[model samples]
Target: MKIGLVCPYSLGTPGGVQNHVRDLAEALLARGHQVSVLAPVDDNEAPPYVVSAGHAVGVPYNGSVARVTFGPRTAARVRSWLADGAFDVVHVHEPMTPSASIIALWAGDGPFVATFHTWQVRSRAMSAAAGLLRPALEKLDARIAVSENARSMMVQHIGGEAVVIPNGLYTKRFAGRIRPDWQGSDGTISFLGRMDEPRKGLGVLLSAVPRLVAERPGLKVLVAGTGQADDVRRSLPSSCRDNVLFLGEIDDAARADMLTGSDVYVAPHLGGESFGIVLLEAMAAGAPVLASDLAAFRQVLDGGRLGELFEPGNATALADQALRLLGSIDERDKLRATGLSAVLRYDWDALIDEILAVYDLVAR
Candidate 1:
């Protein structure tokens, strides 16, 4: 079967939707299905199967800046790609967003499927655009939501129901033996996300650092993602300044190494998380997960049975939980054992068949 995947976000930036599309394409290709991905890309170089829609501009959306593309040129490119590919099914992610996915829905006609991945308490943009978007949305043959939160958002904002399909991951890539250089000591903690984004909650974790370091002088925080490092360092108190190490931007291999080598992996996101993909990555890497008690995260952590959860936006609670987890070797080991077993269920090898079934249903 030939499949065309459309991603609304830029491929050059590291984002959950972009990662999902890339991994899904690779998974399908490995299964001997022909796959092509259409997305906005910043760089000239992309994967052999990726068709660049053009560069993207950052738009403030869902508590963070989303890089997306829109215009006549992008629409023309979308139409041309659809014409050339003539795929059996076209899957557009975040189709309501003002990007390539929506344009693809307008320009192409076939067995169309869309996957919604965002979950917000309320979206004024979605509410305002619902009337205008309904016709294009009606073209979809099937719809999928990455989590129940996402499905609820779609139902509330757009008045539609969708099948719930959680995101997929390549578990083996992160399950490898830890690299020596990336190994962490007793007081080491790791964080991954855009440091400048408040929703990622770097500040919440940073606020807890002084308390953590006071208790354990050897505490070291490893941060990986794109941001202004000097600005972030300046925000920290001088006493615990040297305790944090910023690994500006890292690739997949480095990300796995960083998570695998950490004593604890912290996800401090304040809100706007549909599914905690990074938490699963940490679990797959055998890291003891310590995250905020967001609904999506709570579900991913199995109501805190697999990993530990602290109150959201509470630095004191975060520090206290971190200290307790750091002190208990038995607790961490139990989490690791349970997480490794649970993460396999989300691996692409298992979830791909479910996605293919969706395609089969829509295409038939």
Candidate 2:
């Protein structure tokens, strides 16, 4: 079957939806289905079977910057791409968002499947505009949500029933990757995500550094991903400064290595997380996880059975939990083992069948 996976976000940037689309395309191709990814491309090269509609510009949305193309030219280009692509099924991620996905859904022939990936506390005027948006949304023959949280948001605001299909993982890449050089003795605690993003709670994580190092002088904090280092440093107290190392924007290999080497992986996101993809990545990487008590994190951690949880935005709680988990090697190892076993259910090879079934059902 020929499948066209449409991602509304910029393919050039690193984002959860963009990454999921790319990985899903590859998995579909490996399963012998012809797949093409359609999205706005910037500096990043278009991988095999990827079709770029145009470039994208970042616009603030849902407490984050969304790189999406939403203009007459983009719409025209997307319509042309859809007309020529001749795909049997078009699986669009975030179809309601203003981008190629919306344009394609409006212009392209049906058997359309839309996947919802976000949920926030506030509705952002979308609920009020539902009457105007209903026609466009009705084009979707099937709808999917990455988690129960995402499905609930769609039902409350947009009035739709969507099947929940959690994000898939490149399990072998994280599980079997070699540990990076940074993963040596003295113990490493790692955090991955944009430091300047308040929702990620990097500031809260940094606030715990002083207490963490005071408990274990040899422990090191590895802060990965991109953001303003100065802003992060200002959040850290003077005493904990020396122990924190900023690793700006690491590739997949480095991330896998860091997670494998780290004594603990911290996800301190405050809210608006529909699914815990990074937590699954850490689990797949064999890292003992420590996460905030968000509903999304709890769902991914199996109600705190797979890993430890701290109070959201509470630095003291984070430090205390980290110290307790770090002090016991046996406990960490047990958690890691449990995580590795549990994450297998999310492997792409297993999850793809469910997604393919969605496509087949929609097509029928």
Candidate 3:
């Protein structure tokens, strides 16, 4: 099968949708199918399978910055790619957003599928524009949501029932990449997300860190993602400043190693999480999980069966949960063992057939 995957964001940046598209394309290629990715390119080098449509400009949307390509030149490039690619099926991530995905959805004549990734907070602008966007959305041969919360949001805003197909993770990639140098001696709590992004609740984690480090001596907090590290450090209390290590941005291998070596992986997002891919990655890497009690996080954590959950944005609650988990080695081992077993469901091997089934249904 010749598959074309369209992404709205810049492939250069670390983002959920961009990562999903890249991994999905790789999984397809590994399964003896031809796969090509159409997306915006910034500083990153484009791989052979990637077709760069245009450069993306960062725009604030849904609580974080989305690097998106728009305007006439990009639209023309997208049209050209669609006409020349001759794909069997085009899968567009965030299909409604103004980028290569939407352009491909509008200009392409062949079968297409849209996977909605957002569980949007109520927005008057989205409500008002739904009528205008409905026709283009309905044109999708099949619609998918990464979680039930995302499916509900689509129904509320766009009036449609979408099939639920959760995101896939490369479990094997994370299972064994343990860098000895990256592992710290103390119990480490790792947070992997944009520190400046409010929805990710990095501030909440920062608030919890002071108490966490004081109670458990030699405790280290690893902040591993894109953000202004200096700003984060200066804002921290003087006493616990040395306890936090801001690894500004890390590559995939380092990220996997961090999760593998850490005692606990904390996802402190307040809301707006459609699915928990990072949480799944941590689970696959043998990190005991600690997440906010959001609906989407609950869906991925299976009501805290695999790991632990705390009230979102409450520093005291987060600190208490982290401290408790850090104190007992047995409890931590149990969580890690349970999470590792549960996360195998998300491995690409288990999910590729389901995605291919969707392609078959739409392409026929």
TM-scores vs. true structure, each candidate? 0.98, 0.96, 0.96
Clash totals for all candidate models: 0, 0, 0
lDDT of 3 by residue, 1-364 (tens): 8898999999998888988888898889999998989899986687889988889998877878899998888889988888888889989999767778877866787698889998877678877776666767767888889999999888889886888989989897886555555555558889999887898999999988878877876787889988899988999999999888888899888888889988889999998889989999999999999999999999999999987999998989999988888888999999999999999999888888888999999883
lDDT of 2 by residue, 83-179 (tens): 7778889899987678898888778777799999998774658776555668888888899999989898888878869999999988999954544
Ranking by TM-score: 1, 3, 2
Candidate 3 wrong stretches, greater than 4 Å: 176-186
lDDT of 1 by residue, 1-364 (tens): 9899999999999999999999999999999999999999899778999999989999988888999999999999999999999999999999879999999988889789999999988667778886688889999999999999999999988887899989989999995556655543546799999988999999999999999989987778999999999999998999998889999999888898888887799999999999999999999999999999999999999999988999999999999999999999999899999999999999999999999999999883
lDDT of 2: 0.87
lDDT of each: 0.92, 0.87, 0.87
Runs in model 2 deviating more than 4 A are: 122-124, 176-181
Q: Roughly what TM-score does model 1 have, to 2 decimal places?
A: 0.98
User: How many clashing pairs does model 3 include?
Assistant: 0
Best by TM-score: 1
